[model samples]
Target chain A: MADPRAEILRQAAQLFAQKGYVESSLNELAAAMNYSKGAIYNYFSSKQEIYDAIIIFTLTGLYETAAKAVSEADPPVERLRQFMMAHARFLADNYDCFVTMLVGFSGMANSGLKDDALALRDAHEGLLRRILQAGVADGSFREVSAAMTGRAVLSLLSWMVRWFKPGGGKSAEEVAQEYHDLLVRGLLA
Target chain B: MADPRAEILRQAAQLFAQKGYVESSLNELAAAMNYSKGAIYNYFSSKQEIYDAIIIFTLTGLYETAAKAVSEADPPVERLRQFMMAHARFLADNYDCFVTMLVGFSGMANSGLKDDALALRDAHEGLLRRILQAGVADGSFREVSAAMTGRAVLSLLSWMVRWFKPGGGKSAEEVAQEYHDLLVRGLLA
Candidate 1:
């Protein structure tokens, strides 16, 4: 159930993630896809275009999926936990692609990508903020600074991408559960 | 008093932190220091050399300073809190430099810089890990995975570089204090 273009991005994401944009050449990417270098140009005009596309594709996809997960859940804490688990699943399934886009975006020059990147990040954090705000309004959460607390929680979740190995000791589910419990419920006995 | 050469790196660090490495040119950096481009080259071979030097100088200086702060404290929790506060001050005092080095490191392909970068990170985290382990052993802090906790705490701290505005309403001391409260005491009120 995959589009050919999606297939290309999946591969490109892995390559782009492993070797940065400058280091990842078109010929190598084409060979990985079993196509001529010209075929890549047919899909993407230039490497910069490809990089832009991959970043938007990956980040927008993540935001939308997180939004969907948030909508279908009931309790605010459950919603947050589901969001974390969904994120963990996405990273687990698309490990290299995820890492590549993150590092790429981190190191990219201030191009038009800056606006889009900020917007994407804002949109993703917006989901978490809404949940936190709702919890505060309903007296389910504390009277903390919603923006800072939301950002901190998201930061904690995103840290998984930095250290999570594909075949690490714990499954993504287990890790996500532990994080949610620790962060949301606290360590009070 | 700062050395003349150290002053150059410090100025360059501020520029690189603000404008980014690639966007910043040697001529502008030299001009800021009232030195010609040739004079800068006398100290550094290339812009990349300047960047590498600044990163090593800033992070190593920060690591040593934080280590000293922790050493001057008693009990692991107090030491850990002081370490976090010292780091926050370092980042706050040299916000641009911290942001530049962090964002700059993501894209760098140089093996020498990468090793040093990762090592510097490990050293700081290792210091935290030891404190956390000691706390757990002594029963001041509850049992937890020291490795994951260290990474989580670090991720939370490092994120300040991205969003914290230097002259914002809160001081680094205030923010670091709140962050320490959250990490050590948890959020169960």
Candidate 2:
């Protein structure tokens, strides 16, 4: 984290999240970092590289959070609850980074990093899918399409970025708790 | 729909949705329409005007769809089902405009249209809120925060724009039905 590379990624992510990947320029990123565009080149050759790196960083963070959430739980239902809470906690803690990831993914459909980004996304969603699949197999949850249900639950979590505020009426965990009840109950036999 | 102005808004919306508002240019719009920049200017003063017009158009369509969904239904549950179906239908029927509207709202956060756009959005969410309120009042739905439940329902429906495809494994209405089942069951008293 002490390296200039991580520093550059952090600054550029906030810039891209606010102005968007397409609209942001190296000059703006450089200005935000208080460095010359030449100095930025020492780390990132172009805006796209920075954007891609930020996405990877964000996704890696999500994967780690989801992993930790489920690693401690022995039951599928417990794992599912932990996963949702972890996802919410991650967003609440790193709101700007999560926002950058969402905005970048939606905007960079034609980018060279599309496949890599999508693979990471699928892997993150896979974590949730595995929990659902395990629950259904063990008779903890009813028979339902894991793929569809996973997307629906993730949508409920991700859509919070659109409206969630730090000091709003409900904390991120509280909102996730409500979503968890609705989803878990619906899946229960 | 026959007027050149309507034609311009349609073309601009697609362009803005695809290339984004900040990166899209008047030249690209004119080229897409096969009209010179001057001709485009005759119909619209600036790209901002065209962008604002498209958001208004999309929101108006959403309001009308939500209104018609509840017009004939006497029960809150039926109205809620109709509301979800109508939303899916609207998105299926007008995917690009909806995408354009989503993109425009995100990008133009600092624009002069922010207040107007938010008012429209709140009114649209109000329709769903009223249905939830009525359902809870009559002991049809369980006691829950109408505002939070409405946001959750809308999130389930709105997030479809991110992943819903015409020829996908499930149609928009099918997805809506599954979502309806999960939600209605969760809310049933």
Candidate 3:
């Protein structure tokens, strides 16, 4: 395995998403992992740690992927689209982690990790707002409250985790394009 | 208590939302209800039963509320907006059950109840798609794929469960209006 630790998190994420943090057990995770029950403990001490890792890894990775896509793209409108598409692509690639990050973690025991995860989520929101602000400043998008627009766009994109499934008809990118069409058309000056 | 059975469901919904389906306990629920553990069992045989009741009660209520608002509204566009606003009101009026309905029931044991819930959810989607279709038919909305537009609108509204809170800056109605503004403007020909 390229990264046994990462593998544990990946396997655990599916377990966590399918069940939940409170319902999941390392014994079950170990069975899923094909590792000794203690082997998981070697990588992470508790399920909470693994969940913390998921929140951190998923949100941090999600933000990085989206930010990179936004930065590589041109003016704000395309960047906004890029941000949504990138988020879709990331969630599609890491379905379990995205599910855990978005819906499965709410009742989780709050800690610095949960705070960190929320901060990363907020940072991603900030990125979208900045893109909207840039779009309006550059006369690409209509004048609107970037904060509210950011929340709306994030809602459309984030809600995908709940509904978008691989081969659930449309690819994540395809769905993202439809959302992008609606959003961009809505925002175009 | 308004209705003892409903009171049980309401208390159970908060417990389910705060913990989760598998993690929640009828004992805890009874404590929340100020009823004995045996009293809870008298109302619902199992946690699964409580969850089933929640799925049935919440989705059926939500769909009916939306359908009534849509039927009572004027044009298709207004109907669509009313559907969303009615949903927000329902969710706000029934916070715990909405939370349980929206995010907490996944991964629960599938049964006729889940199928019923999904059908109700699809019925709601059908209502939205029909509105978009009506809007397009009447030239009140642009020629858009009603299916995709319905999905987008549902995404925008459903995700509110995750973020919208009473007195959390914007009321759910206000947030729905903002989303409605984005959506209606987007679909305007």
Candidate 4:
């Protein structure tokens, strides 16, 4: 069985994602998790703590997944494509985390977790930027603002959460391939 | 002088965009607008009403701007480029409105304006789909999923609001042109 703390975080993330964080209550989360309110308090002190945990977990998970996807052994272009595919696959598998991150980041000003979330996001963006920079250096990619291009690519992948339905027409892998083709070819010199 | 109602909306949108709609109070909005709370109520019955007005105003403005940007005389590629540029310019010029729309749409489920907001969003996307379909039909663009491609394009454009700093580096036109070149050429046969 998963650790009770981990299970609590997972359930809390799902509830926060489905219902906005503001609307999701600890009682409801406890009900969904089949845990008593006292059980929840043992894992998380407050709803805000639960929300902060979700934000940190989601952002860190995304960054680590993408970072692991890229390899120096591959050509920079291939690495970039792999990074994008990893991102899409993560979003597809962790739909709740993706939604939580999106809603959390949008409301960051209201949440005390703003700086940590932004740092995680920036680090993820940095990984993409470095890949683009490498591609530019290797003459595989055209000259473009690596920062802007990285954001553009990240935006493309991140927006998948808004429309990509797991059981819907296109599988995540298929969508990733399409995006890979569109973006990789678009960046080629 | 502008209509008092329109002025109220413009000010409210700015406030809501900077501070979220949920956080922006009528008293603060009235203070920003130099109107008494009573006067604000005279114009908008409630904060929700002000938010609804902002939604209607922003979405309608975006659709109208994009509609006027496309020309029948231009080839499908040029029309697409024009459409993208027009969107970037609109976003840059109407920064507050764009931000308001983003925050509003994210919280649409809680707001009574969900259906209306979705309808406006779909209409805006329809314009892009039509452009992509026209390109595919005319052989200017390679075979692609018009609906998916449309969303992809809009995602690239819409995500600009998060990172685009007006005077920091590239102008909106420059960003738009780069995006046009990247996306339009990617779609080219």
Whole-model lDDT per candidate: 0.75, 0.80, 0.81, 0.80
Choose the strongest candidate by TM-score.
Answer: 3
Specify the CAPRI tier of model 4: acceptable
DockQ of the candidate models in sequence: 0.29, 0.41, 0.47, 0.32
Q: Which 10 consecutive positions of candidate 4 chain B have the poorest summed lDDT?
A: B180-189
Global CA lDDT of candidate 1, please? 0.75
Compute the lDDT of residue B69 as modeled in candidate 1: 85
Q: Which candidate gets the maximum DockQ versus the true structure? A: 3
Q: What share of the true interface contacts does candidate 2 keep?
A: 0.31
For model 3, the TM-score of its B chain against the native B chain is 0.91
Report the lDDT tens digits of candidate 2 across residue range B70-185: 86448888788888888888888777777776554675665787788778888888998988888878888777787877888888988887788767788888898888877776
lDDT of 2 by residue, A40-125 (tens): 99988888778778887777888788888786448887788889999998888778777777665775565788787788888989
Candidate 3: tens digits of C-alpha lDDT, residues A1-189:
889999999998899788767778899999887889887777888888888898889889889999888873487777877998998898899999878876666744565576777799889989888888887787777677888888888888888887778877899999888888887665212
Error of 3 at B47 (Å): 1.4
Worst 10 residues of 1 chain B by lDDT: B180-189
- CAPRI classification of candidate 2: acceptable
Tens digits of lDDT, candidate 4, B81-139: 88888888888888887788765666555677768877887888898889888888887
Model 4 steric clash pairs: none
Give the residue spans of candidate 3 off by over 4 A: A187-189, B187-189
Kindly report the TM-score of the first chain in candidate 1: 0.89
Task: Kindly list the per-residue Cα lDDT of model 3 for residues B117-155, writing each as its tens digit.
Answer: 789889988988888888888787767788888888878
- Provide fnat values for all models in the order shown: 0.18, 0.31, 0.46, 0.21
